[model samples]
Target: MISINNLTFEIGSRALYDEANWHIKPGDKVGLIGANGAGKSTLLRLIVGQYAPTSGTISMAKDLKIGYLNQDLLSYHSDKSILYVAMEAFERQNQLHAEIEDLLAKLETDYSDDILNKLSDRQLEFEALDGYNVEFKAHEILAGLGFSEEEQKRPLATFSGGWRMRVMLAKILLQTPDILLLDEPTNHMDLPSIKWLENYLQAFDGAIVIVSHDRYFLDRIIKKTVESRKGKLTLYAGNYSFYLEEKELRNELQANQFKNQQAKIKQEERLIERFRAKASKAKMAQSRIKALDRMERIEDVDDDNPTVNFSFKFSKPSGRHVVTLDHISKSYPNLEILKNTSAIIEKGDKIALIGANGKGKSTLLRIVAGADNQFEGKSEHGHNVSQTFFAQHQLEALHLENSILAELQAFAPKHTETELRSILGCFLFTGDDAFKKIKVLSGGEKSRVALAKALTADANFLALDEPTNHLDMQSVNILIQALQQFEGTFIVVSHDRYFLDHVANKIWYIEDKEIKEYPGTYQEYEEWASKRLVKTEVKPEKKVKEEPKVKKEKQAPSEDRTRLLSKKNKELSTLEKKIEEQEISVKDLEQKLADEAVYSDATKLQETTRAYNSAKAELTHYQEQWEQLAEEIMELEND
Candidate 1:
């Protein structure tokens, strides 16, 4: 659908792309992956003609429609109703419908030949575009995007920025453009809505190019990954997982090639040096020197190695119970954020708090961390439970006036300036970068500094809210590993599936005004969710019928025994399948949920959550049945 040829773009001295060649074909689901500052978004803009390339051309077929969604730029007014804005995507249809209506009205009268010809032509055009079903299609798209029937009728102005983005997404999805460009699309979506989007995109009949940090989202949706690095693009076939494996293999090969080339160049240089020292071999030495000069230098492939070593050394173990909440309820005016919630954090426990946006996951974290205390329930930190709270806004809470070095040094242990600078360097703040004011730092840089500060506190109980925000995959992985090895208790609120799966042993899911605990990894939680969905879908209705006591007694044993055995077998099979499916679903959801685009679609997320919950419930029921069946089988065998 679109072709980028010999593209070169630069901002001052930093070249974002150099002679980059990339193409987006019809029905292509391409994921743009790269390290922070690698210009994945920039490349997207170049493709959309939002910015002109310094050199080369971006060519597109005539009349090719494109829909681009940027993270920071959304044109929406709160005053307009959500449905009205969404309906605008089919404005052409709406206009045609109106014209057809007007033409029909004219048909009722004795119209001139010119008017008749115009009316007939308009009718043909309207029929060809399926203008009759435009309203129905718009409604379908809006509902799919998670906009409630009532909310869709409400003015867009009443919705928050996140909801506004959903409205924007609904518009684009309804438009069904030839090419879709999305950046960080999933930042605001919940799990249920994300699943809906996955299904939608699976059936999307166009090319899609998205930039996201969510590995699960990419793995599930993308067929190819275009990685930007060091002013070049590398294409990897298959999903994000495939890309990771293939990229590692390619990097290894590149490293080996670089080593071999260096070795050969070094040997040649040695021989040339030796030969040059001999007068008789001076001519040969000169020829060798020329050859060395003419040889193209082997370039090193860039790898996203973790810059910071975030190893935490806890000074002492805390009490058995890290933190406890009892009968906790919180509200903002009439809005009840959380209600009668109770939870416990035991020593060495890693818990993930998950919920929709504004569902009070963060509020719950705050109450546990003692940031907010005006609640109905009691929150108590166990003896010696020294806690460190990393809020989502920690990046913004830093001392902006202080230099990066000064900021870290203020909280850092008393050490030499050089040592302090070295610590800063580990987080990618090196040389004069340490002198840069904290206020001047980018969102990612500020996050790193905040993390550095949190690490220095030496807290035994860590409560982090969205710590993975503004961090690239490399940084997120580093943090994940650090948390995995840390002995401290961790309670985190994050949407980053990879990080959650890697570190969390339990999940506290906030849904339908309740917080439910799942005692397992993300994979197990997914199984439980899937089973729940199955139960809901295939629930058997109860029937009331009178029967004679003698007849009931006679039929009960056989029926009950057969039903029990059949149910047991079915449950066991379902459990086994769920275990396998959950493993895959968790891995898939974790990857895609991390993508920025998937998060943006509230409707899709709502659907995904529904599907996920169904799967989870079904799996949980099956697991319980399987355990019971195992016991029954053992008893029967023993008898």
Candidate 2:
């Protein structure tokens, strides 16, 4: 378990965290979330000792181990195979294997009992460490992360940064440390790989702190949510969805209190102003003024979700058909991407191109955008169609020397500086942030600028590939709103299910080297696809006799059995009463803990938490006793 108490971390003049406290208990699954500049990732680094906090303590058990998977690991390169890299996590096992090999070689020449005994000991240690399964685990993890068996054998240096990051994640997962600190683990993952990871993490025994923008992924995995805001950390008792609802309620309460306090202040000010004009009431007015000064001022709640008011600009409308692909056949030396595949994109079509990695989603996007003409295909554009293709590579196309505002101005010459800055604000760049050079911006910031350029273009047909890569939840929501308001057509390739569900009206996927379309929203497509999979997977079962049934005479209870059943019923009744009392006690303690007044007081919160847990344990004990007695009674009555 890791405990972060009264933590204060500062960067230059800015305090990223001030008195932020979080306790990560054993088997705790937490989602760390905040705005773009809110310091979620920085806190993770502080915990792992990569960055030292300005003050306070982050203490963990002496024997505890941590495995961290971060974006910086993308730069890690090695000529060794990915399997070898992942197996490196088993340091002791690998050493024992090396020793065993050395001992075996010496024994071949010496044929000595000492060498034999050492070899036997090393082999036993290796077996005890489960060293033989290390390779299998590495392979399994690599495959789950979207690497093929052949790919696993390939050198780590051969893969791109994203794929390399997956290898690093595999290595961390293979370590099986006491805790995992994952920063944007789903960043480069495809849908299948993301789902596989979700399943894997669900079964992970250690604690996890995941910082991700994927709402669905957070909801599926984390049991607790922590928000970093204004140099303070706030804990939510539930997942992302629950946090959203709870946050809204808290905001409403705070807003109401603030409003009431402001009204009280205004009333007090008016009374003081009137009374100050009279010499007789001057003393009372002064006393009221002092009281008002001493009163605690309630801070108003800040708006977390900003509205999207910027509509995309388009010069002209396209014809009915936006894009048409005919008999497309694309192939590499060994892998066939598309074989005689065809698809059509019509006006106003919001298509989500999704599938497993290496399924030609990007390749198909390139073909559709007319960015790639090497393939054998008949690709045609509609009349008066203007197209803008947005991809990760476009980030490299940005001018590093230009300021954020200047970059947008260069892309959209028609827009004024104020208009460009306003556009930048929608992407989370505000005030002095827009003046920052593109070279200094983070990957997510660069992504926002690129997406801003793409949306600002005078194009009616857009081709977006992984547009939500580094965006936060709020930014993604802004993009969704912008896309929903736009009249243009687009085909986006993203693994974010939440973004897809909101923005896409149709789903496109590659299957059997051909383009397939489901003429429905992403949610509908998921339901249909899951039902199809079930239909294919399920087989009819033949009826079989379950077991021999008890005879009617045997089912009749004897006098001794009846007495036992009566005794069990009495015990079960008493247990039911005790269980009810304990349940009420637990609920009372829970309600007390839920109160802000109680929770804000450390001693009260601790006492209530302990009492709640004890009450819960007592209730569980009574329920178990009741179940056992009820089962025994059922058996006795049957006999």
List the RMSD of every prediction in angstroms.
11.9, 16.2
Please write out the lDDT profile of model 2 over residues 77-146, one tens digit for every residue: 7999989998899999999989998988788789888888888899989999999998899889999999
Candidate 1: tens digits of C-alpha lDDT, residues 269-342: 89998889899999999998999899998778765765545456667779999898887878898678878877
The 10-residue segment of model 2 with minimum total lDDT is: 539-548
Clashes in candidate 1: how many?
51
Question: Which candidate number maximizes TM-score?
Answer: 2
TM-score per prediction, in order, is 0.81, 0.83
The residue ranges of model 2 lying beyond 4 angstroms of the native Cα positions read: 416-418, 538-639
Error of 2 at 562 (Å): 69
Tell how far residue 528 is off in model 2, in angstroms. Answer: 1.6
